[model samples]
Target: MHEITFSTVDKPKLLSQLTSLLAEIGLNIQEAHAFSTADGFSLDVFVVDGWREETEELKSVLERGILKYKEQYLSKRHVVSSVNEHYQVKIEPLSNCIAIPSDGTDVWEIDTTQLKTENKVGSGSFGDLYRGTYCSQEVAIKVLKPERVNAEMLREFSQEVYIMRKIRHKNVVQFIGACTRPPNLCIVTEFMSRGSVYDFLHKQRGVFKLPSLLKVGIDVSKGMNYLHQNNIIHRDLKTANLLMDENEVVKVADFGVARVQAQSGVMTAETGTYRWMAPEVIEHKPYDQKADVFSFGISLWELLTGELPYSYLTPLQAAVGVVQKGLRPTIPKNTHPRLAELLERCWQQDPTNRPDFSEILDILQHIKRK
Candidate 1:
């Protein structure tokens, strides 16, 4: 294996771009590492094979490839003259907030005056989730931090609203409304009182009995099946995105990375968390709705064991293992034979071999009935 390292300015999708460039050069990456420096730079290293050329030749080829990539992809013009100039240029056009395309249906533009925010319930890189009240009804509000607001963030927020507004299911989190006006930009949804399954399992030291486990599996499968039926894929299907209500009902939440599949039924570009990511996705291969099935399998394993998948390895190591060595979380010997079989089928290396959510739901329901 030849080790290659790159250092450049850090930006969104930088890792994905580097990985794609490596793949384009016919490199089979066995290991990968990425680090962000305090000075706003990224250092990425990859150990790869499949290049049978001399080291000097490989270096020349990679240098040329990077130049071509920059010419073809990177912007030539400076995006902003300065921070102040950038803020001034961005704020006015976005002041009215994202304009989601309409299908002549009712829009849920929330009145900020009626929204009452209490304590923060959760936080993420770009936003804070609050336990709030909207017009006397309990709601969870996700507010974007104004300082972090940018074009890409607004696009994601708009896409999420576009998807959420059209979906309504008991097994899926319900969308309430959105305050699309800038600086106060936020999305509101029904409050899930019990928090996330990750917290329930890891924080509270909880374990699901067989019956409850099957119920959770069924709930998630049903939700996924609904999404798949509608041509939507929940690229990130992990315990963290699965939330519970006061009555212990599990519903799939978080659609920030979720997307409606293209007409061709395949997508590229890496999205979602690493540990739960499918092998094809980690490899940046063309993938479809089946990618979500693979993630659901890893998530089902989490529900069964109450342990993080590949807890023994760092996330990048886990990703490399999954793609290079076909690694999966070990199923306990005491696990139900049928469920164990289902897990294996779901983790099949070939996407076609994986069971669809509809089939998975049937299998889980059968296990419960038996």
Candidate 2:
């Protein structure tokens, strides 16, 4: 495998551009390594095959692309800085505040007074989620806990807020707005009355009819397909991240750890909870959107059986079993053969063998018709 490396400031869409450049050279990437320092400087590496007689030409193209990327980044920063001078948006000053891009993105800046926080609903690594009302509408407010407020965490929260603003899909949670005030940074989204799928399935001892299970599968696949099409990777895809509405329609939620696809068609660092994490991810190997598909397989199994995968084992045990022994959750004997087959494909040891979300959607649609 041929290896390539570079470093740049971490930003959205940077990976898409790098991967697009590699593909333009007709290289089939086999592995990727990416990491960032505390100051947002990213180091990326890629391993590839399928080299033709155009190696020299490929080098020239990559060198030119890197220069172009730096130029564009500088230009965009200059423009945003200039626009912020004239814009009257009330932004609270904080040492940990993320630089919100002001290039006409539709991220609504909600006044802090408009949101009314009620009871706490859940908690995440960085924030406490609450049931709240915004502009007379029920919403979920994720407030970054004061103790966790830091440059890195704030940057991640900002990234999630920015990404949520750009996505609009029935299968994806709707972003309402955000309160950028210091000591109370919050992200607000349309609340799903039914809460998360994990609670519906395991916590409440819920069972799903085959038809309903198929529908849930389709909904998640559709959302993921849209994300992939936009070159985004929902690094953490699990039942807990899937919310249900009053009608039980599933919508993808929680993006604090999600990221835009990197230049190597994969990211190097480990992410997502271990139970739903792919083997590649667990091992800190290179992984791309296919990693999400692996998580979906475990989620689909959970939907079908209403049981946690490897319930008897610790998360670390399950992760070890998956990575070291290629173990997968056992399918219920009564499960449909087709469904079992689909799950196997999704959790394939070789990520390249796993089908994309679009194909997964088609298969679910076919199952729904049966």
For candidate 2, the per-residue lDDT at 51 reads: 71
My TM-score estimates for the predictions, one after another, are 0.78, 0.75
Runs in model 2 deviating more than 4 A are: 1-93
For residues 1-370, could you state the per-residue lDDT of candidate 1 as single tens digits? 5767676765655666777888899987765645454345555656677888677688878887787777776445111111121122243346565788779778699988899999999997569999999999999999988866777578889989999998999999999999888878899999999999999999999999899999999999988899899988888899999999999899999998788887888876446778888887776567889999899899889989999999998676688789889999999999999999999999888999999999999999999999
Model 2 deviation from the true structure expressed as Cα RMSD, one decimal place: 14.0
Model 1 misplaced stretches (Cα beyond 4 Å): 1-95
Would you list the clashing residue pairs of candidate 1?
Answer: none
lDDT of 1 at 256: 86
Candidate 2 whole-model C-alpha lDDT, 0 to 1: 0.78
The TM-score measured for candidate 1 stands at 0.78
lDDT of 2 by residue, 1-370 (tens): 4556656665544444556666776767654444554455555556666775455555666677656655865344311100111112224346644566666846588877788999999985457999989988999998987754656567777889878888899999999988776776889999999999999888888898899999999999999999988888998899999999998889999988788787767676545777888887766466788999999999999999898888888565576688889989889899888898999999999999999999999988987888
